[model samples]
Target: MKMPFFTSFILLVLITQIAIRRTSYKIESKEADFWEKERKANFTRKKPLDNLNYIKIPLDSLPFGKLDDDESRYCEKVIRSLADQKVVNLTGFTNTDLKLEYGAPNITELTKYDQNYTTLVTNLQKWGKLLYDAELYNEATTVLEFATDTGTDVTATYKLLTDLYQNKLTLSDSEKKEKISALLPVAEELRSLSKDQIKRLLTESL
Candidate 1:
C-alpha cells in the first residue's frame, strides 16, 4: 500500500534533519581535533630555557685561569644541578667567588655591574630628553647605540626616535609653531607629564 502524503513529508523532514545534525557534528569534531593538535605542538616546541634555572654570575667572580679546568667543570656541574632543581639564586656562590677572585676591599662585582647599568639608563634618559627638546633627532639615535635587547620602555624609545627622524626636516620655526599648535589639544588632555613623558609627546609629534 502507498504511504499517505503527510507521512512521506514527515519522514523526509526527519531524514534531512538527521543528515544536517551529522554534518554539524563532524565539522565540530574536526575543529576540536585541529585545536588539540595545535596545543600539543605548541607545548612540545616551548623553549627548554623557559623551564630551566639561570645562574647569574658577576664578571669578577668567574674563575679565570687556563689551568683551573677541574674547578670550572665543578662550577658547570653546580649550575646544571641548580637548573635541574629550578633554584635560580646563585648569589651565595657568586659572592664567595668574588671575594676569592678580587682579593681587595672594594665594591663587589655585582654592585659595579648594577652601577654600570644604572649609569647607562640614566644617560640614555638624559640624552633622549635633551635631543627631543633641542629637536636634534639624528643625534638622539646615539643614546640607544648600545641597546642590546628590547625592554618595556625601549620600544617606545625606538618609536620616538623614528618619529624624530621622520620629522627632523619639518622643524623650521614656522613648522614648529604649526606642530605645537596641533599638539595643544593633546597637551590639554594630558595636563601633567614627567620629563620623559614630555619628551615622548614631542618625539611622537614628529
Candidate 2:
C-alpha cells in the first residue's frame, strides 16, 4: 500500500531541515578557521621597532669629511665640546632611503644661524622618527608637520603618520583634537607654497 500523503510530507520536511542544518554548520566552521589563521598571522609578524636600524651621522657630511687634517682636528675639538648636548635618539628609524641625512650628533655648536633647509628638514624628520619609535605618535606627526611646512615633499611621511594616528587607540579625544589643531598651520603653509618654490627651496637647501 502507498504511504499516506501527510507521512510523505513529514519525511520531506525533516530531510530539508537536516540539510539546512548541515550547510549552516559547514559555514560556521569555515568562518572559525579563517579567524584562527588571521590571528596566527598577526601574532607572527615582526615588530616595527625591531626592524629599524638607525645610524647616527654628522649633520653636514661633506663639510666635515672634506676638512684638512688641522681643520679636522679643530672640528673634532668642537664636536667634543658639544658632546653633552641632548639630541633626540633616532635608534628606531630605518637607514634605507636616508642616504643623504641621518640622525644628528648631540652637538648644538654645529648648528648655525641661516641653516640650510635640508638641515632643518632632516632634523625634523629625525625627531619625528624618534618620537614614533618611542610610541609618541602625536608628537611624531607634529614634527613631520614641520617638515611638510618647510616644503620637504612629505607625502610619504604624512601617509605613515596617518597610519599611526588611525591605529592609535590609546589617545583621548582631547589629545587627538590638540594634534589636529597643531597640524593646521603646517597644512596651511604647505598649501601656500607654489610647487616651483617648494622645489627651489629643496634645491637651495640640498
Candidate 3:
C-alpha cells in the first residue's frame, strides 16, 4: 500500500530534522572537547626547551650585503643585530605543540624567539632586494642564497632568489634551471601562507 504524499513528506521532514540535530550535537561536543583540552594545556607543567633547535646567524660570512648606500647600511645594521638574538623558526608548530613541549608558561618566550627569526628573514629579504636594487648582483646573490638556505618561510626571500637565478646571475641556462629546481622542495616545505605564490613565482619566472 502506498503512503499518502503528505504523510511521506512529513516523514522526510522528521528524518531531516533528526539528522540536523545529530550533526549539531556532534559539532557542539567537538568544540566543547577542544576547549577543555586547551584549558588543561594552559596549566601544563614546565618542560626543558633544550631539544628545540635555534638559529644562529653567521655575521662574518655575509660581507656582501652593504655598499656605499644608506639603505644597505641600515639593512646591515638590522642583520647584524639579529646575530645575537634568540632566533628560531617554529613555522609548522602550533600553540598546542608549544605548550606540550615547552609548557604553557614558556610559550611567550618561545614565541618571542620565533619572532626574532621572523625579523631576521624579513630583513634578509629586504637586504637582498636592497643589494639587487643597487645593481650589486653578486652581493644580492650571496644574501638571498643565505636566506633561502636558512629555510626561511618568507616568500619574498624565495622570490628574490628566483629573480637572481633566472635573470640577474651570470649562470648558464642549465645552471640557472638547476638552481631554480633546487628551490622546489624548499617552497614545498614552507609553512607560510604565501607558499603558493612562491611556487608560482618559481615556475612562471623560469
Q: What is the lDDT of candidate 2?
A: 0.46
Q: Could you give candidate 3's per-residue lDDT for residues 44-63 as a string of tens digits?
A: 99988887778777787786
lDDT for model 1, please. 0.43
Model 3: what TM-score? 0.81
Residue-level lDDT tens digits of model 2 in 1-206? 36688899999999999999999999999999866754554444233233332223344421222323553445444433333332223322223212113222211211221123334455555555555666666666655654554445444555445455546536666664564455444444553234344434333322
Q: Relative to the true structure, how large is the alpha-carbon lDDT of every model?
A: 0.43, 0.46, 0.82
Q: Return model 2's CA RMSD, one decimal.
A: 19.4
Which has the greatest TM-score? Answer: 3
What is residue 29's positional error in candidate 1, in angstroms? 40
Query: How would you encode candidate 1's per-residue C-alpha lDDT over 47-66 as one tens digit per residue?
Result: 22343223332224322221
In angstroms, the error of model 1 at 58 is 23
**Lowest-lDDT window of 10 residues in candidate 2?**
105-114
Query: Which scores higher on lDDT, 2 or 3?
Result: 3
Alpha-carbon error at 125 in model 2, in Å?
1.1
